[model samples]
Target: MMNITIKRIIIGICTTIILLTIYLLVPQVSNPSPSYETKLTHGTPVSDDIRAMLTPSIEPKRTRAIMVMQDGKVIYEYGPTDKIMNGHSTRKAMLSLLYGIAVDKKLINLDKTLSELDIDEYIPLTTQEKSATIRDLLMGKSSIYLPASGEHDNQITQRPKRESHKPGTYFFNNNFDANALGTIFIKETETSIGEFMEEYLAKPLGLQDFDSDNVIMGSPWFMPKKKTMHEQYYIYISTRDFARIGSMVANKGRWNGKQIISEDWIIKSTSSHSDLSNNHINYGRYDGFGYQWWTASDTNTIWTDGYGERFMIIDPDKRLTLVEQNFTGNSLLSSGLWLMNKNMDSGLSNLMKAHKTLAKNK
Candidate 1:
């Protein structure tokens, strides 16, 4: 019996030693935190005030995440803001950023017509749709049409089918419409969309461990996974890095004193490129679309939207970046926008008040 007990003790000690060695060698904790040091006159007390502004007006059935960064400091964060979460179509914002970098590098000409490029095979649009330029698709004006046709239809109710249009006249979001962009990305860049995202946007932004692919079709994650649908139709990002990307956009795509993407491209991508004519189409409190980015003309806050309430809102005038993630439907996006507008309204008021107070003391 003593021999048996001794053997068990020895095994336990060996396991503990192995774990200790791994703890030391693996370097689990990241060192030298991501650079957030930048100068701004706003005092740090606003973090508390911002947190107070995040109380949702509605009963919280959905999971909500929020992060606010002002002047390079994380002023406030609420809810499950640390966990990795889906960023729905908000991924388009990063994709647009990648597109801009491609333009800046001369890899793509934003004005280049589809016919001149001879990459018509990828786009399933008819002749009219084929005439649509890269800018058209970026601005959400492509002839691509979704199955539901401007209604709140879930993915399960729809299987994306290609419409035989004249190829540049009308736009919809079908499989062909979404996948064609991926094909064109591969053809021109000689790299997959995932590769392009990494090489251009994510890597430079220090999101080296991110993952994204052109998922052909699947339901929103909140829905039960469908049969035979191997992949979902969006990019997943941790909420934290999602906020990091927003901060980068708010700073005009600069991180850690490095120009990850050109400032001019950032500006153009986030501004109002075109007016979405359809009154039925909801753009989450935005007045217009700008190269995959949504612009709130009223607040001058440009944002990228994802399905399931993922948002990366950048307020240039206030120098604030807000990111929010929610599992519920458009309510998160709508409410988050409402909450953001409230915070921006209140936060700026506080800062101005603080400035006035300082002025009086001086």
Candidate 2:
């Protein structure tokens, strides 16, 4: 009888161990962090009325996520809040913010020219291209006509010949300019841009979804010839974290009362530096170019939009920041381009409508 009892106890223990192992192996859906206030106690609650207004505007399959924050609190959220998505060109805005901090710390000089830094090791820059200053590149006025990788826009790839326009005179939203700026940023700061951002911006801003591992550095697929330049770089982050970055901009570089980035830099970077009204690449109405940020001519809003229907729009006047993420596909060169464009148009229209609705409700 004692022997039988021992066998039964062993069996029970083994079963318990197996069950515990199964429980441990199974994935658990964690509760949202307490830092993020999902409750609508802070600002105007995203009421049923608002949801009804915004729901019809969204294309469910095309838009992966949307997050809207008002007065530094999340007023609305949709889709998986934790979903990580490629930042695409919207990463340029983060780079711009880093440039602001770098400038504020006197680590970078805006007047620095390409020639002085010897930035043309791969394909020697012409005298005019070399004359393009860091400021000009930041302002999207760099006239350097080098073929840029990862750029799907026909306007830039089929643009005029090199040195057709003087540096700082004309504005073309070219990836070559942004890539060159990234190179310059690394050379001047004596550290990788991603490392700097992770240390300074991401940490201080409390970006829950950003990891330094997500920073991709290398050449874009289109430009195989430019091996030395490594022109294409991107950062993958969640829409919620993107909203946090936008909120920082909306609050004039202040996050939780701490001056994360200088307010002066924010003002300068978001201010209109180029007139993009006549440009064929339509970035909605009242579109203008700033320091890697898009400015609206009609409203006091600054935004960064990516190729794959991802956007972070900040309206300082309204104290609002909206971030949208839509994953079209791996490559913009594919048939996904049409869907991407459609998604972008629909998303922007809905966001604007929602903003108007919020204003009217308030």
Candidate 3:
């Protein structure tokens, strides 16, 4: 009887192991999301003719990845979408997202003066600088031009003389505003940018790359002085994950059926606060500057740019989100004697043209 019992027990253990292995190996089907749309399914890319049309501009040697999503699904993709690349200046847009959430929760008021927030640089803020509001900073109108932490070498060289312009009057793309805003965001929300981003965005949006360990975080790369405060808040994100960010904004801050960010904030933040038509070549016909987001003259569209030729163009009118990144060299100046460090906008421009054609056909 003991031998029989031992054999049965061993068999039972084997059976349990086999069952557990089977469960682990099989793909589990998750319950459908409330706003699940059959049309939003992936794997079926756009037609061959369209791909051929896009290949020349998008699949060059230096190009890393290009993903164009229509109606929240990948319509065309070139290169590896899983690769995480340096975010550069595009990190400002992500900070703006955090600001939206904070503002929505009434934790930070846009109109609050810098003085009220106790924002001051080691160089000391002028009375006019202290009077600049958070909204002015977001809009790049905080005319308080001191030696800013993380201020770009070129931007520093171009920095308007200290206290030259008053707050909310001029629009200069300064790293100071972005960095200071980041510092303010952390202080007000009592959360690190990485934690807020991972919790508020990555996890909820089902991002494939960069979990808690590798989530987007800030680093002090552009700090010129040892005593300087705010760091250049950097975010390392993948192409596909950024497409999701674009899609989220394109939907006016809605993800699936849930309202991830308020539509009012999206509209307000994306609307052009500074007119950049005469300057900034990146903006289209009537495009201008918004709160960290570059506003297109075209209705219902926002453009986010990264230094060295990265871009995320979100067009709500066409239900499209396009992302391109990682240019090893400027193809435009590769053969030229002077290969300047200028950004190559050809890929994105070509993509925009293709998008317009596709939208018209649809």
* Highest-scoring model, TM-score: 2
Task: Put down candidate 1 lDDT per residue, 243-268, tens digits, no spaces.
Answer: 67777787887877888888998887
TM-score ranking, high to low: 2, 3, 1
The regions of model 1 sitting more than 4 angstroms off are 1-47, 55-62, 115-124, 146-178, 208-233, 277-284, 327-362
Write one digit per residue (lDDT tens) for candidate 2, span 151-228.
776645567678889999987888888888888888899978778887888778877765565566773233335454
Give the whole-model CA lDDT for all candidates, comma-separated. Answer: 0.56, 0.76, 0.73
Off by over 4 Å in 2: 1-42, 56-59, 219-228, 278-283, 328-346, 360-362
Which residue runs of candidate 3 sit more than 4 Å off their true CA positions? 1-40, 57-59, 212-227, 278-286, 298-300, 327-346
Query: TM-score of the candidate numbered 1?
Result: 0.64
lDDT of 3 by residue, 260-311 (tens): 8899988888888987765433334446788999876764468888776788
Q: How high is the lDDT of residue 208 in model 3?
A: 68
What TM-score should be assigned to candidate 2?
0.80
Question: For each candidate, what TM-score against the reference?
Answer: 0.64, 0.80, 0.77
> C-alpha displacement of 155 in model 3, angstroms?
2.3
